[model samples]
Target: MRDMHESSADFSDSCIKEEVLKEKLLRPARDIRSILRWGYPKFSTIRFVADHFQLSLEERHILARVIMPPDRIISRINKKIDCSEIKDRKILIDGYNVLLTVDSLLKKELMWFCDDGYIRDTRYYFSKAKQAEDIEEALDAVLGFLSEASPKSVFFLFDAQISRSGELAGFTRRKLKEYKISGEAKTSKIADFELKTEGGNPESNVIVATSDGIIIDSVKEVLDIPACLMEKMGIEPIRLY
Candidate 1:
């Protein structure tokens, strides 16, 4: 049954990738023409092209316009747009949920605990090391993806109980700040209560990033905001929206 499930997931992923490839191949000639006419080869041209193609909402929303560094002439001709016009959006992330999904930490620990015999200790240490590596890589991937997406603000909230170590807490705070993200440690003692209290008007514009069924229900009930999970073992969110 597990094998079958894995096979099905692989097939679904392949189908999604194929669809993205097809969309990429169907770029509108008019989009190129418009870019040339305006003499400004901005990434927004991709949005215009996607709209022209009547792409699916999911694809259109996630589509990022890749603006290459223009040649000397185009660079000189095109002026940078003011930042004021850009919509400032915030993302509220369920930190422990994201960490579990990305690193499979709980699953690894469970496997280690369930192991037996003389090799158990060695296996446990090895899994811990691997989990650390996985967490670091996942963090880097997620931060990089979010940075490229260009949201105005991102707030990541983690359960303080689960990440009680000062070193880990400090590391998360510093790393997120380095990426211009506002990271908060929510005490497990009042996790949901804090979220409910903070989930209000201006935060209404915030998108909650989590896949926990209960968390999703609460966010919907409180703010009716949009949400998405951080992709772990598959294509990044930028590719899928």
Candidate 2:
């Protein structure tokens, strides 16, 4: 799967001085979708086609992530549940997945608005989330919403392999308590299996809150927490709505 994206060019990251021009590059990326529907090719190939336009390295990555998602992935995204759908349901959160994304957005970091209409943080999350200063606030923001969404319960699952995941699980549970939401967190060696198996039960009123594409594909419904939070804050992301 890692072979799906490749470093195409050593395009300079100097677009900070030309933000307006950079936005126009999205036009070419939009057209790139025509060929992408055929399959997920190396970003190098797309870069070869886009070379004439002089796009920055970051711009190219954004375009690739947004446009190059496989057709099956797009089909799954259509089943993503909305905030309204979770009003009376329970939510199973891929803990780090949600926290890392919210923290990145809160810190004004670069995020990708992909073809599936979901905002994604391109950073290697497991390494970077530990370095973020607002990790607790990110957790609180997510929990606060579940409190209001009136879900029957919420389950937060963190990967045990990650550093301080047990600590994160404890913190998440406490936040749930403070918010008066019925929920708890757990550290799992196989969180993917745990979520996929438990959330797949048709009799359960469980909806998952995560941006992990693989996990999302395994479940019946997913809720986009950051998108909901941003909507409440009146920040409309480009093409994500």
Candidate 3:
């Protein structure tokens, strides 16, 4: 086995080298961004981007997060509200989207700072039991911040299709209560569709909380709550190829 001091030096060297690689990814990310802006499907673009970069699927996955389509999408993403602006506004959280992003932060999963500067993550597919701890951590992180923001109200929407979603909704309500945050939890057959409608309505005074690109585009305002927390904690995205 390596000595402790030797191991520490090795870790430091590897860590710096990894950071360099992540920085280097920006080149390919720009290329991929250009490909996407030309109306290419991301599915096809992803494979082509991966092949062009000569990277593994995981590397491509992380890179895809950073590479996004041009202007229209970027403009929509820019409409998101700053974390500091969340105070006193009613927030409708894209529950899984926000929750999973923070969970990924904790797991050191791939995070992409999109062209418009908002951060996003992709890793919501998993069994509930396997995600219990992450779910709890994610909820606590965002709700705790909202508690500080003192939002007028919050609405947490989960996907009905996911197993134990109802149970998770209940847990979320209790957590809101514990945090002294005002919120209701509901499971939806299509949370995205519901959130799109609700958050888009000017009369609702509801700001969305999600990193989902589609929902972000549809809503008038968004709060990348998970992104805020991750940044606050100096939690960097995972680097693995």
Worst 10 residues of 2 by lDDT: 1-10
lDDT of 2 by residue, 174-233 (tens): 778889998789999999998887777777758888877677777778789988888776
> Which has the greatest lDDT?
3
Clashes found in each candidate (C-alpha, N, C closer than 3 A): 0, 0, 0
Model 3: which residue pairs collide? none
TM-score of each: 0.42, 0.80, 0.83
Candidate lDDT scores, in order, read 0.42, 0.71, 0.75
A best-first ranking of the candidates according to their TM-score comes to: 3, 2, 1
The alpha-carbon deviation from the true structure for residue 61 of candidate 3, after best TM-score superposition, in angstroms, is 1.7
Show where candidate 3 strays beyond 4 Å: 1-17, 20-24, 35-43, 122-134, 236-241
What is the overall TM-score of model 3 with all chains considered together? 0.83
TM-score of model number 2? 0.80
| Candidate number that wins on TM-score, 1 or 2 | 2
Clashing pairs in 1: none
- For residues 1-241, write the lDDT of model 1, one tens digit per residue: 1124457777677567756653563354335444756666545675677667776554443333222223432322222122222235565666555554444322221111100000011111232222234466556655665665666666666555553533444566667778775445333556555554454335475555554333443443211111121122222222211
